[model samples]
Target: MGYFKDILKYEKKYRRFTVLNIVFNILYAFFNVLSVLAFIPVLNILFGAEKRVIDKPEYNNISDLGNYLEGSFNYFISQKIISEGEIKALSLICIISLSLFFFKNFFRYLASYVITFLRTGIVKDLRDNLYHKIVELPISYFSEKRKGDIIARMTSDVQEVEVSILTSIETLVREPLTVIISIGIMLFMSVKLTLFVFILLPVSGFIISSISKKLKAKSIKAQKETGTFLSFIEETLTGLRIIKGFNAENVIEKKFNNSTLSFKQLMTSVFHRQTLASPMSEFLGSATIITILWFGGTEVLNNTSTLEAGKFMGYIVLFYTVLNPIKLITTTFYNIQKGEASAERIMSVLNTKNEIKDLPNANAKEGFNDKIEFKNISFKYKKEYVLKDFSLTINKGETVALVGQSGSGKSTLANLITRFYDVNKGEVLIDGQNIKSITKKSLRGLMGIVSQDSILFNDTVENNIKLGSQNASHDAIKEASEIANAAEFIEDLPEKYLTNIGDSGNTLSGGQKQRLSIARAVLKNPPIMILDEATSALDTESEQLVQVALEKMMQNRTSLVIAHRLSTIQKANLIVVMKKGEIVEQGKHEELLAKKGEYFKLVTMQSLS
Candidate 1:
């Protein structure tokens, strides 16, 4: 129920629809009681229990109103029966009951109809907000989170909420009102029997509640297992080639099967407990009815009750009517318990504060100027610093190359400049202004990053090239593609630029994908370009072509080049050699080579390889 309080905010958002649902549900409950009570007059007509009255009943206070109405109705029916016969009287009663039943169902339909908007609207908004949060959160936030777990939150957990909570909105409103109205009618018909019924109900509620107490814990376990298996699925699809190559499919399959089996076992227990609500409530309700039947029958037989034979029969039916609603409410409570588990998971994400949000007075940087400088910055993904007290300055329009082994912090410089992760100490600056003070959108806007993986979407070549620069004309895309050496192969495809590259551009060769990535950066034409080993994964000929395009794109731009192959940085304005997160040496290509230091050793190693 506390989790329900968190979800009430969404209800407020769709308040108009929620209010309509409540209003119509109240009508439905009122008619639900009337439809059952309509049977009392029918029973009176059938049993010939009418009492004669010469005049109409007078207006009176509500205390004796029930008896007065009963007497008045019997008197009217007696006159009708005396004139019209039993068949006509029975026919009139049947028609009134039928109308009451019809209106009851009609209002029920209206309540359901109005609530559909609120239910689906909340689900839609949940998805929208989830996606926005996923996209807006910093890259570092995802490093420790499983991709499948996040996907599970968006898919399975949301579906659970829809089934358990959102769908219960109608039952939450309608069923209790139905129970309340039914009890009111029963009390008017006979208060002592209703009071006996009230005594038995709390005991039944306690039993149902006891059964549902452990449901939330089980549901949470089930949801987590679902995420675990889904992670296995995502991982299998992503690394299918490697798995098959290593003949490790059986190992992965076993892990996934075990995960699903655990999920299946947990859900079996959860659903069994959930299903108990119906029969358990039904049994308890039937027991209460039997108790009422004994007591009310004794009172009637002894003439100690105000309820007559006909009204007592109607009272029994109305009390039985109350059972179904009470049963429904019990089931709804169990469902909400299950929903509470999912609600907690969903809110954990929605309520998460982004650690990398812009400051209150953050300024939007227009474009790059002066220089990009790392002022004694220290950053760490976890405990150990990846870059420590590292400092460098790349002036505008200068191409600076950082050369190092895999873990020597070459690529980390690009990450820091782009603010993918912030420094634990010191500052990153552009034109003497701290990057933390600049709006992230504008700070990244001045840069173009092309990494070694050649990340591309499942889109056409022209569209992929136009990704960051969506409004660019076709001519601009073509000109950029030609500069990146991608236009030649793109035009050779059957559909030319319109050809759909399959997922992540898998249909293209490695070199072609790399060229498309380069074309994308070329199209953006940002002043600051970060080429993170753009040609590192290619063969001799492909690397030659991609390297040529990289040089073309880097022309007249302030560029940070992270290179493993020393040949690529031979002509850089400044080449910095790094060792264990510290700059070992930095100078022009010939100057560093002449010193026979770390840079010279790197050149010698690459030349031999």
Candidate 2:
């Protein structure tokens, strides 16, 4: 219920629509009761049970208002019968009943019409907000979550909220009004009979509530299973090549089948409980109506009840109208219970605290000055530290290279400097100020990164290059591509710069993809660059071409290059050798090779002179 209430808070933006819906629903309910009550006159005319009234009844005190209206209507019908005959009077009554029915349905449609705007509007805003939250969340958040699970929340869970919760809103608003108005008229007709109805309703309501008590818990399990299977599907698609290559298709298929089996079982239970709402409520409503019929019918037969046969039949029809709404209300309750689970999942992501965000007084860093310094920094992904009390300094325009074996915390330095993950202990200072004191957008704007993977979208070559500098002119893009040694290949493509690269730019060779990444960085034209093993995955010939592009991009920039191959960093101004989160050697490449230490050992292992 709390989650449902939170979701309703989004409706404030569509408050006008909500007000319109309520207004029309009120009209619909009023006319709905009137239409049912209209049949009373027709029944009286058919059975000749209404007495002749020559004079119209006078309006008096509010207490006698009900009798006055009923008397006045009967007198008019009697006049019609005398002047026009019983056939014409009955025709007039039918026409009046038909008009009442028309107005009832008209207002009901209007209520549904206006609510459509509110429902679609809320769903759009919810998706937009969720997407913004996902984008703004720190990179480390995704490291602990599955891409497929997040996709499930964004897609299926949102759909569930729309289906179960938003759809039930109309029922919640309209049905209750219908039930109230019908019951009020019933109480007016016979309080003793209505009182008995009230008792029977609460007992039925208690039974229905108890049946749906565990529905929310089961719904949560079912929705979570949906995420689990969706994650399995995403994983399978992503790693399909590996699965087939390893001949582990059977293993993967078995795992996927198990996940789907669990999901099917959970959904089966959920549907069984959800589908039971309608029939169970209908049965209870019918049982209550039967009891009322016996009690009211017995009294009417003995002439003790004020309700004549015709009027009692009308009462039963009016009570039957109330029954349908009560049944829908119970179904709505079940739907909301089911929808609350998805709402909770959505709110979980929306309500997550983004730990990395700009502070109130954070300054915008416009340009780089003196040096970038890591002062006694410590960081870790989980328990063990990756960088321990590590300190380094790179002056402006210095192209420093970090060389180390795997798990030696080379890339962690790039992550920390870029503020993708904050240090556990110490500060990363740009010039003399702490990086944390700078706004993230401005901090990131000063640097361009080229990682091992060339992450390109399924767009044109020019558009991929324009990612960092979206508004760059065509000439500027061309110049950047030329600087990265990618212009020759770009011109050879079918559509030149307008050529659509397939997913992840798989249409291009590894060298071409890496150069495009460099071209993107070149377009940003930042003063600082971080190259994280950019050519490690390329072939020998591709490495030479990408290396040429890297050297071109690093010129006059303060660069921190994390390298796996010792050959790439041989020409770097200073080389730092790391081992187990500590710097073991730092010198010019030739100087370190002369020392016959860690750096020399790395170069020797690489079979370099």
Candidate 3:
């Protein structure tokens, strides 16, 4: 119920709907009881249960309460004197009974109608909140999570929470009220019989509850399995080309099938456990009914009760109504049990602590000044360090290149400088202030990055380049493209800047996309730039074009370049060579070449014919 309470809190926004629903439901319950009593007066008129008194009728005990009610109704009939010959009292009682039935149904419909807004409203609000949480969560959280699993929670899991749980609002209120009203009437019929119900209810509740004890734990596993399989499907679709290339379709399919088989088993278990609720509760209610019949029949036979045969039959029927509600109440418990899994999954995301929120009193840096300093910084994704005791300083308007092997933590350095991830052990200062003390927005705004992959979008070329600088003019965009050497091919395209690049710029060649990425950075023209082997993936002619664009971009900025090819950093004012995580060499490109150390070894390997 703690999970259910979390879901309920969303209804606070629609509290007016809640109040209105309550009002109509109360009216419905009152009329339902009144409707059942209406039948009593009609029965009294027909069966002559109404006492024809020597003097005016007077009140009796509550069981005699129904008797007094019938007598008073009879007096009203006799006083009216509007006799239509076919038993005026019976016709009058019939009219009231029919009217009570009409209003009983009317109020019931109104209650349901009012709750429609509340249920859908809560569903909408819950989904919106979850979406916001997903967007706000840091990218690191997604590293170990499946994309498909997240999608499933957003779509299928949320929908299940809505249909299975939100739709229970009617049952959540009306069923309990129905039982309360029915039990009240039954008590007035005989408190002695009602006491038997009290005993019967608890035992049945205990039995039904025991069946659902482990239901929540199983349900949580089922939902997790759903996420796992969805992740598998998502991974399969994403890498379908590679899978087909390697002829590993059967391998993936078998794994997918295994995941699906497990999901099926879990769901079957959940259903069977849930299905036990109604039957077990129903059987228990039936036993209670049989017990009442035995005890009540004996009283009537011994002349110790005044309940007539028809009224007794009607009371038994009303008690049968209580059976369904008891069953439904038990079913809701199981449903809540199942919903616990969804609630836990959804809450996990919603309740995640944001690791990258701005500090209070954080001030925005006005612009880049002094030097960008990496002072004895270190970091790790897990336990051991990936970049240990790494340090470098790019003086304002200088070009610095980082040359290293594949896993030598070049990319990790880029991530740290960009503050995509924070360093663990030391400070990354900019213009003599700690990067952590500055607002992230202002710090990131001062820099531009062009990664190895040359990330693009399935949008117009203009939109992609003008991303951060949304209001950049066409002329400015054209100049940036020209400077990046992308203008020639861009203009050759049918729509030029307006042309769609397709997904991740897949429509264009590698070098063309890289040039456009450089163009985007040029347009931003931030004081600082980081190029992660940007031109390495290009063909010979395209590589030359992009290398020229890079020289132009780094002309007067504090630039940090990571190069795999060694030759690209020949003109760098300072060349820093790294092995693993530590910088093994540093100085002017000529000075590093003269060292004949790791830097020279890399150059010799790459410079050969």
Candidate 4:
């Protein structure tokens, strides 16, 4: 009814394993009863009380039942003592009994072994789907969610699903089965005594259910707090340098203290509810057994019941055997309730609709032909539309530079071109086809993107640069590196192409990383490229080096360049000056400067004395 089924939807892939596990578990339960019955025979012989038969046992009704047993015992001992083999027959029965006991355990182990595959397979698929969903979601999703919370769902929350739910599946199937089988055996022995057991079950079930109700609430809070603290931890790692730089260690520490305190409160509640399961079940079980002995003993001692002394003790032991499974089942219910929270969290990610999925019947965008058009396109992150009635066009193989101050929709234009957030109104088209109508992979395949952040994985220099084109040969990678002017410094490194860049390529300088980004774009050799303030964060020399490399990559491709530095794009084919999401000026650098308009003012403001 909830995320349990949603999370277990992954288990459908292991249907064969599930069927086999159920079969083995059924066999295990059957033998669990037989193993207990094996003791009945041993006790029968020891107490000189094995059921016997008198005369020829008839094939009739309950009136003939005593005669059947009386006849059975007479024939057995008469043949045994005559041949002096009664003890040998007894030993043979014991051996068979032991074998049944061993087979039961063997099948039980098989059930556990088969279910291992299903549990681990579900976990692996859940994690894989979570990661896939994370990437496909709009960037705005990450903007609102904490990084630590996402990481917690992937790690700790998933582990909870494994430990609390996946691990309990066997108990879900096996424990109830053991309870049912034990109750059946107890009934066959004496239904009056068995019905007494039935009355106790509903009471035990009620108390366990009550404890489990509180578990889900506390477990949900615990998981939420785990996410909150994990977010704080992730933030601290990324901003450690900033925290120290500003001497704000105490402020950050206080924030962390608050998160952990909240987490501790929630977990305390969860564990408290979990602790109730064992003792409550144990008490109920003891009470049920004591009641059985008091009532059953009266009938046995008064000769009102046929149950013998050893047989009566064995039935009590058999009922006791169910006590542990019943207690375990109680604990399992609490665990499932706790794990239900994690399954909901995991399913939330898995169920999240990707905002950037491909259009139905979408096809790969071939190489660019006609000019790219941004025709009356409008968009926003949320609420207010930032780009209203916006339109522009970039010719083939021309660099169109977008320039403006912050919050003026300069970067929005860059993002829209990459389809990071699809336009809320109108359309962006390549050639004549709407960008939305083409698969994102195919559409993006034609363009090389270099963002202001220079996103790079923690990997080798060669791998980072080759990310845009993984099939590029080493010589081609070197050629691309040389073109971006990154080859000289790369050669000086200890491992050259094989050096690890650490997280986000932090081992490389801003300029060096930017050059590497350009090198990556160069290797891709796309028909169009988007460069968002590529050299804006660099010092003078670093800016010049990165700029020259970027210019080299831009030589033959259609480019959309967003620049804060006016000097870098003075030679751009056309400069589009924007203000508050509207184009105020669009023409060559000289023409916009000659007009003494918005573009001219921006340049005048940034000019050297």
Order by TM-score, highest first: 2, 1, 4, 3
lDDT, candidate 4, 227-293, per-residue tens:
9888888889889999999999999999899989988988888888888888988998898889889
- TM-scores for the candidates: 0.97, 0.98, 0.90, 0.93
Extract clashing residue pairs from model 4: 52-69, 52-70, 52-73, 53-69, 53-70, 53-71, 53-72, 53-73, 54-70, 54-71
Candidate 1 lDDT (Cα, 0 to 1): 0.89
Error at 224, model 3, angstroms: 0.9
Identify the runs in model 1 with alpha carbons over 4 angstroms from their true place. 50-54, 62-64
RMSD of each: 1.6, 1.4, 3.2, 2.7
Ranking by lDDT: 2, 1, 4, 3
Q: List clashing residue pairs in candidate 2.
A: none
Per-residue CA lDDT of model 1 for 409-504, tens digit only, reads: 888888888888888998999999999999999999999999999899998888899999999999999999999999999999989999999999
lDDT of each: 0.89, 0.92, 0.83, 0.85
Model 4, clash count? 10
Q: Highest lDDT, which number?
A: 2
Worst 10 residues of 4 by lDDT: 50-59
Total clashes in model 1, counting residue pairs 3 or more apart in sequence or in different chains: 0
